[model samples]
Target: MASFLDIIKRHLALSIWAFSIIAGILLSQTSIDFRAGVSRLAMNSLYLPFTSFSRTYHLLRDRRVENLRLKEELTTSKLRVEALKEAQRENERLRRLIGFSEKIEYSNLLAEVIGRGTPRMPGSLVVGAGSDRGVIVGLPVIDENGLVGKVIAVNDRSCVIQPLNDPNFKISAIDARSRINGIVSSNSRGKIIMENVPADADIRRGDAVLSSGLGGLFPEGLLIGRVGRVSVPQSGLFMTVEIDPAALLDRLEEVFILFVGIAGEGESGVEPPEAQ
Candidate 1:
């Protein structure tokens, strides 16, 4: 009952307009004198209501169209703003990479990340440069932070690189502080693991780890990461070690591929690249 009353209230204006139309039709049917002045006055009276209704309808229609246009303009403005912010961030990252490359000894090719490796293969990324730009397999890649990965496969225009955190990746590393040698590998969770360390080794938490140059693949003294955890198996003679990589592998966008061998090979402390 209350609902029915609310519905009727909402449509009361329409109902009144319909009722007026019916009442006017019934009045016209009555036996009335056809005087010219009275007929003209009646026609004028009926014309006003329909003229107001038509004007109201057109005004409401125009308002709705204007509101839609404003909403579209707002949406487009938001998208443009976001695009500009992203471009600015990318420029900053590139600037940092260029500065880091100039400080390093190796001649490097700045490569942009094009895509990621297949889901079946973890810790791999596809870079924009390939054999066409002299990018060869086994070239080391790094960013402003530290070592990123090594090129595994190369094509004419692109190449695939395996990051240091991949399960199958391994590097000969040493404790930077104590000068102790160890083998670094990745576990299933992509965490760095230093294996085959004697239980009596002089390693502890927060020790810096770096490449030992034993494998001949990576240059000596490249920053790997810091030690996180140290434990010993009850039966084994060696200790289990966890390492944190110097680079953030998951969020890399641009990197430098080392072709000249060592960082700061020619001269040290060069000027930073100009910001674009």
Candidate 2:
């Protein structure tokens, strides 16, 4: 019985193949419209899904690339903004210095501080201006707030300034409030110590000290420092006063060299000498 069924199945498959072949031959003899319609249907069914998948993948990849590019641009923009803000702050500080310098009416030659002296000679600094810019020895150097130092040596394009903390640098100063006079000099402990103040002087802490113009080096009334502490030692006849300099020596970057004009009647307020 199984052998009879197997034979029937094989005959059925052969009959189907013979019938399809006959159908194809008949179709080939027909018009071109039928072939065109079959080809179009096959293309739409087989190629459409593959083409759509490829286009979608490329679109997603392009969007990811665009997002990464935008993020990088934003980071660069933020860094540029920070740099610009720092520059603006620096410019404002310089402008404030310039305005303060002009208000003092002191003839000023601006210069940048290039280097600091060695630790053994910590009371001196090197500046970028020198004799070529009218910088001379004994000229007072100051910053926006007050006196910084004085030029002790001058070269072609640079000068050395001896700060107020130098042992040899002394200035005649008067109390801003009480008008008490004293001599300010540097102590061995790297401090400005005021001496020669009378025992009965009314000098107090926090009093501002200004140049008295007794020493021909510094002009009159230039700010020096404020008195920090005052003490009357048991062995000393004078009051020992400590001063805190107005200029921030550690942070110095720029300074103004004061230039005293020649004797004249107009701007400088001095009359010229008569012909000899």
Candidate 3:
């Protein structure tokens, strides 16, 4: 039951054999070297086609291997580029942090933000410095931008900071333009707002809000945020004002622990910061 293709293959093989023998005989008539003439004929008619096929296959395989190697090298280069970019960005951040620390008059301890708040201390962050580094509760924490929070709890290795966004965190803020007074606190939803503003207060949107140094907790003139919105209460003596925090609290990486005697600094052996 040979198919058409099988029958053709058999005939083709026989024709090849006949052609090789005839070509050898004709070449052998004129050529003085009989073995060399037959060998040349067999090489041209039989071995050359197979050799050409093998060479093409090897070339294609080598090209594929080279392409894979190039792809691997390209991927490695991309990863290295990304790592370098990250390093450059980190370097810039540290430079800015150092510059801010130098400009401030207070003696500050540099601290790294290690972790976010836990369940026991919502809306807070853990700093790498603790009592061992002269960090104590009530020390104000700040970043390159401005005031961040105050240290609330400390252990041997770390301390927790109650960020401005915390529900219980509050500071006396004032309008830098007009010296109008108000209290800055975060709402239950973590939105920062200025409370207890007089109804006819000169405070307005775009005013710079700063710590007034009234509560004896935070130092004066530290930036709190810019006033965003101002509203009047229907039946109250004060206006409702919202202020944006100066520091990017959610992305905090490092901060300075201001060593001013805020509160509860006794028994900690920390030196008082010089007045500005």
The prediction achieving the highest TM-score against the true structure is 3
Maximum-lDDT candidate: 3
Give a tens-digit lDDT track for model 2, residues 72-176. Answer: 999999999999999998789889878877886766777899989946566689999877777767778899879898888889889999998888888888898
lDDT of 2 at 74: 97
lDDT of 1 by residue, 1-276 (tens): 999778778999987888899998987776666556677787689776787788899999999999999999999999999999998988887777778878977667788888887576655999998888877787778877778878888898899999988888888899999899989999887678998788889998999998887756787778888999888778878998999888878887888887733333422222222320
Q: In order, what is each prediction's RMSD in angstroms? A: 12.4, 10.6, 9.0
Q: Whole-model Cα lDDT per candidate?
A: 0.81, 0.82, 0.86
Regions of candidate 1 where Cα sits further than 4 Å from its true position: 1-45, 119-122, 261-276
Model 1 clashing residue pairs (backbone): 104-264, 105-263, 105-264, 105-265
Task: Provide the TM-score for each candidate, comma-separated.
Answer: 0.73, 0.69, 0.77
**Model 2 regions more than 4 Å off:** 1-68, 118-120, 261-276
Number of clashing pairs per prediction, in order? 4, 1, 0
